[model samples]
Target chain A: MTTAGQAPGQAQANLIAIPRDWAYDFLLFTHRNPKPCPVLDVLDAGETVSALKQDADVRTHAPRYRIWENGELKAEPENATDYWRDDLVTFLIGCSFTFETALTNAGVPLRHVDQGKNVSMYVTDIQCRPAGRLHGPMVVSMRWIPESLVDMAHKVTALMPSVHGAPVGAGDPRMLGIEDIDAPDFGDAVEHEPGDVPVFWACGVTPQAVLMKSRPPFAITHAPGQMFVTDMPDFAYRVG
Target chain B: MTTAGQAPGQAQANLIAIPRDWAYDFLLFTHRNPKPCPVLDVLDAGETVSALKQDADVRTHAPRYRIWENGELKAEPENATDYWRDDLVTFLIGCSFTFETALTNAGVPLRHVDQGKNVSMYVTDIQCRPAGRLHGPMVVSMRWIPESLVDMAHKVTALMPSVHGAPVGAGDPRMLGIEDIDAPDFGDAVEHEPGDVPVFWACGVTPQAVLMKSRPPFAITHAPGQMFVTDMPDFAYRVG
Candidate 1:
């Protein structure tokens, strides 16, 4: 059994804590590298009110925090007590951990994880439907599937809707309106060998881009890689 | 085929328009009665620019409009040109009419249509999740189903999510927090036979009740029964 009070570093990293405004940038950075920074929880401003989990204090839960101002990196803080507000709304969107587990269980080889590099992400010209003040093109994470099991790969991942769902566009990346797949919008570019169709799924970084574009007066999100572990079982979000 | 030049009477009766300050009440009413008053659209007070449908001139689209002043049905007019403002945000919600066709097509007997009376509705203890200024108990429409096929009835109606989408409660009226099934909160109640179960679907009149409770300074909704005719096909909203 993995206890919440195991390693001090892992415990503090997983705990919820109220982060300073500077923590926003750190979280955004983590969101950029979704494979490593899969978000599990977000605390609105003020006293880290626990919405999805119990005893999950946002002030001192996570070990570290980063802040961003006007899309620029600002500072990193152990906790975010000074940069809290009353109007902030927290969103506990799905993380990629669930999908990674599915892929690994299904015997799909992951290149980025194996090479110790960030998963490839790119900004597609295809626009996401804007919600309220949030508007931007979609940022997709790519995975290369071998020719033999591409169909099975799609079928397996398509079951999880909340965790980014099935690939938005498969086959050629150019069809998704990307001019140069080599120069991705964020993250490192990975080599795609023959017989591997680059699969893309809407990344959790979508909300970050939305947050950046909307520029809400005040907001708080999970620092990437630091996630609030929940009792919510992953299978609950899956569909047949 | 329903001709376009039908004087917009039935469609106009579906329009719910109010002054700028009453926006909150309008949203409330939508939450309360989700069936009959299914919010077809909202034209924010000052942003009179219609985007969802053409010929929906907020000021003069409906053949007739009702102005509610402090819960009182005060004035009837053809246009709200004098009450235009810039702060309003229009919302196009789903309507029950979108699903009624499906129910009839599936051989579900609609008593109100057969008797030429308004579908019966009542306020229940079921409270809708509050969003911003809108908050209130849910109102539901009652229907009768034969004893043998009640399960099939639920399966048939559950398919239409945009419309009311299945009964919230079945069998007993008292269980719905409704007393004296004949005395409906709004609309006239119909007779239910010995072998019939009183099935209820979320009512569209919810927004009105919510709007009245929230009491935004200005708001507007379609007068009951009248609706905006949309260009999109109803099947477009159905999910398989």
Candidate 2:
């Protein structure tokens, strides 16, 4: 049996099974805010989804759920056993938290996370290498780093190849093909002190635009700002 | 107007454009000793194959050429202009010199190069990831290194992804699924000093075996110990 839950600024607790439609909206919201809402897993239909933690019931895991029909929000369901379906595919996309954690551990400061603001995201002209039905321009989350540590920053982040390694471009925002730095495609802007260059990493929000463009007949994801935590520790990724 | 000429550490004095029938034996000799004979380019019948070096004249550019016919060495021609054909395909493969240069730059000492002996190569049970019409067990060149710095060595070399990055395995020889390390399938075995571990990198010989297996209608490659030295620097592959 599998259980799912979400916690703000912490690990998720409790588990719940919700309607297919609710799963879709929850995933959409999470897609909209991926950094805080990292998706861990989605259960296949006819499969008994249980948390690896093995305590929480997914039947009523998260405190809330939202249902969407034809791209419109339909209902707020506390529990959704009736809405379960025979065919549902789950996804586990990486979150920015992994890299953010890495950056902080390396002593690089992040203003957005410090100020309780969303990391600014920009859709660049650079096209992502597409896979299967998924196709979209890469969306990048920005952070400012001291000029002295720019090279160190690159070396540190490049090690995390799985979760968007290294910045697409540094020094000039225009080189990334972004028109304006202040007016970003998404999220709130932050202060960039002098001698600071903006660094960018591929954002997890990519799948949202991809899904909207791809428009699969059915989908389910975690709600925005609510993420599914997993058993994987960040330390496992470090290469010797 | 890039012309093939004498590359460093190459025993061949000049690049020779030989007739297809005459080049077979030289190609066979190259297959016999692949570490020293990294194939860079092959031009057939002159349909403008451009992957190896820019605008190479298979004939005239190479100072000497050998012509092979039906598993027999027949002629050594200065140029095979009259023997050129449109049916031949060129193969540009990685050279050991590239990886050796990379290792030296990263401070990983090479015993064979330092001792002026051929690097020891072993045939391993590990198989090369096959491509179209190519298949063979991987041949790896061994370099002795300090056991403590093994991790750093893997990291530094792994960055050179195009030129066989990282060791497939380290420490025990049998652990790599190889029964014997002392008696290599090819090349001279070197002495392993105390506190040294044997490190292995994929050798270019893989394609030759693959070619023999595929038995392409016709192919051309650089002679043993002869490589097509390019103007491109080693660092071009480090990042991207």
Candidate 3:
């Protein structure tokens, strides 16, 4: 189900599954870290049907699934049937792709998308408000918006708080303990043109980073950039 | 610490305490219902000091507390020292007072406050997104804002997503299944002036309603309108 060569906008063709018993903990994790782990939908244990998508199967619909055990990547299976359990609960998290669309609609250009590069992400000194055993520095995705459009970008993204909301910081990476703007902890960095300002929004990679650091005994998450697409329209997330 | 006779905007001069073992579940409940249960501060198990306030004591700070067992209100105590346990976790939820301050700063008048009546609240047909065993209809607080100030009210309140971002509905109460504006499931109803629009915000009472319906084995929350006062300023909740 992998769509590796797909167009720039089409990613997130997968789902992540975790043991049902840990479902509440994971939900708490996302709630405590709204910007990085905005929950789009959730499926109860033993339920294959998605509340966000009709005819969607949690096991087979996702083009890919990454299984992590004790903080180690054990498998990237095409389908999770072999690991599917009645007690496994599924969660669909909001992806930045939705906000990127909103930004584009508001006339903000995405340099990374234009250059066909992954948006640059960095591990910052900012500590996420912890929930249970999940605690780690917030991961943020940086974009270069024209100085004039920075406020517009902020408003556009702020309308959708569920998807990381507005940028956590703008102008200075050093303030966030990011020593180098050219180097990122994850993804490819794009160049900033003249008159552009460096802006950062909470990255969805945060949960994955916390999982890697905290090393929960068992967990599952969609591979980076591969999310579970929902039937809900982008505008559905926008608020007044 | 009770401020019962204080003027409007000076309430929330108290704190509530409960058993520490149920702290995580209670935190999960607040996270799932942020609007009604905005967590202003949380104390670790066995800790009585709140990170949000200096010289604050959870045991004797709150003027009053309502204890619930098996979903029934069992006690209203002036001090919870008798019930305090090492594992009891305490959370301070965000109150409408924060958003009302924002609205006032933006030149929007709160009718309930001016009329010296409690904000009208109703149990809607809309179901709150469930977390664990907690699930119930969303409860909303309604205030009448002049038609001209509705947009300003929205922009002001939307800045505080932690407290209940924007009005879920503005003009017609019937859209939210609220049949009579004069009749509220909770709180006193305030009169609407000519050209006033009834605006609804997700209420903090929602989590309480959910707890009552779901009937968690044990739980504790501030009595309505009697919230935990945090040293944090109201503007802290406002976003760009």
Candidate 4:
């Protein structure tokens, strides 16, 4: 099931597990490109438990996992325990659910959620600030909001910069290099009704897309729309 | 010269250069302890020119440099070119000046800047989140603000989370392990007059202190009261 709008107040996270040797650069990559990678927690090498939540084992906590070998998709496993290695470091990145909850609470209706479809994600031409060994374009998630409530939506998400922050663009898809609004790079596209303005936010899928380009010898990430919910309050990420 | 009042609009940074071997761990330490180490610019190994500023060299842009070997102070030089190495990775962290300028611009009078003294800083008992090979207690810089204006100071600084953010504590230094308010571990002590409240902020000196404890074989840092000013506008850090 899609994780968006699930566990209202609890924060959900995007998962990225890489070899310990590549953990440092990945951490740097997150810091340098914070809009796309708000770090929730970084489990040390070989750690399976999350410090942010009680009794949550990353190896089997998530509903699904995507394993990669040298930039090639290898398997979509029900659990990552079989793929878990002592030399792996797992990174929990802030997911959009935290902000979607905030948006829903603020009276901003999301078309994707209403249409029962996963949020559309696109790989933009915007290049992320490259770290030592990783470099790739940014990926963004799209939500159709009423034109009248665009400012309100921006204000709400701006308060929670940890969850992809505010919309990167509001009215135009071409500016971000997305040719067709209906053709998303990831997830299913939803219906766009009248007076709806397409809003784009930095997506946690960015690092995953980068991993595909940089070709890390081995890596694992959460399957699309499948997330790990943490006990930490969503308001804990509020900056304003 | 002190950097607190200088560079009214531009941002200032705390410098930390270490062997490339320790750069990854040090980068993680900064990310985990962002309040005390809000990263501004991290120069890749062997890079002397700052990506944030024009024609500024880390080796000579700052007025003074403190060289450390095995956790002990080895030398204080006017320039670091002699000590520079290809394997050295330099990290420029956010300095309090950016926020202090915002505080001043917001009409919050600072006693340290008014009295022409270096801001008093103390080592707190609060431990930083350990990352890889580095961990230590948090250090705090104290600013005495008028009792009624403390809220204004907080509101102003809270907008600049990238530069040490809001105050960690407002009153009672003893709670932070500072027994003698007049005897500061770093910088000069300032007089606390009537209607003044002591506000403490996470300081940039924290990583330097941690270096002393973790004992990295070689490191270089900016001398106290000396800092590098970057061309990046201070308002770029505002969250609201």
Worst 10 residues of 3 chain B by lDDT: B2-11
Candidate 2 residue A14 Cα shift, in angstroms, is: 21
Task: After superposing candidate 2 on the true structure, give the runs of residues whose Cα lies further than 4 Å from its correct spot.
Answer: A1-94, A130-134, A146-149, A179-186, A191-196, A213-228, B1-98, B107-141, B146-152, B158-169, B183-196, B200-240
lDDT of 2 by residue, B12-34 (tens): 21133333343333333333333
| Highest DockQ against the true fold, candidate | 4
Q: Candidate 3's fnat?
A: 0.20
Report the C-alpha displacement of residue A93, candidate 2, in angstroms: 4.8
- Please provide, for model 2 over A1-240, each residue's C-alpha lDDT reduced to its tens digit, 9 standing for 90 to 100: 111111212233212233444343444333323222234444443444543334543434444444444333455555544555554433345555455666667778777767666667787776654433434566677888888877777777666543455676786888778888888776677788898888887766555444445554544333432334545555433332
Scored by Cα lDDT, where does model 2 land? 0.51
Could you give candidate 1's per-residue lDDT for residues B1-240 as a string of tens digits?
A: 111223211222244545544444344344334443444445544655344457566666644545655555556666766655566555455655555556666777666666656567788888776644556777787777676667766776665544666678897888879988899876667776678778888866666666667565665555444445566566644433
Ranking by lDDT: 4, 3, 1, 2
What TM-score goes with each of the models?
0.68, 0.52, 0.83, 0.97
**Candidate 4 structure quality by residue, lDDT tens digits, B1-240:** 677677788888889999989987898798789899988778788989887886878989888899999889899998989998899998989888778778888888878888888899998899999888898899999999999999998888876778888889998998898898899888889997899989999989898889888999999999866888889998888775
Sort the predicted structures by TM-score, highest score first: 4, 3, 1, 2
lDDT of 1 at B119: 66
For model 1, how does the per-residue alpha-carbon lDDT over A141-170 read when each residue is reduced to its tens digit? 777777776776677766664466567778
lDDT of candidate 4 over A32-125, digit per residue (tens): 8989998888888898888877687897777888999988889999798898889989899988878887888899997877887888999999
Better of 1 and 2 by DockQ: 1
Q: Pick the candidate with the highest TM-score.
A: 4
Q: TM-scores for chain A, candidates in order?
A: 0.70, 0.67, 0.86, 0.97
**Model 3 Cα lDDT, one tens digit per residue, A1-240:** 222223333323224566755665666677667777776666667788876677777776655667778778888776767877787777777666677776777799988878777678899999988866768888888999999999999988877776677789999899988999999987777888899999998877787777777777666666665556666776666665
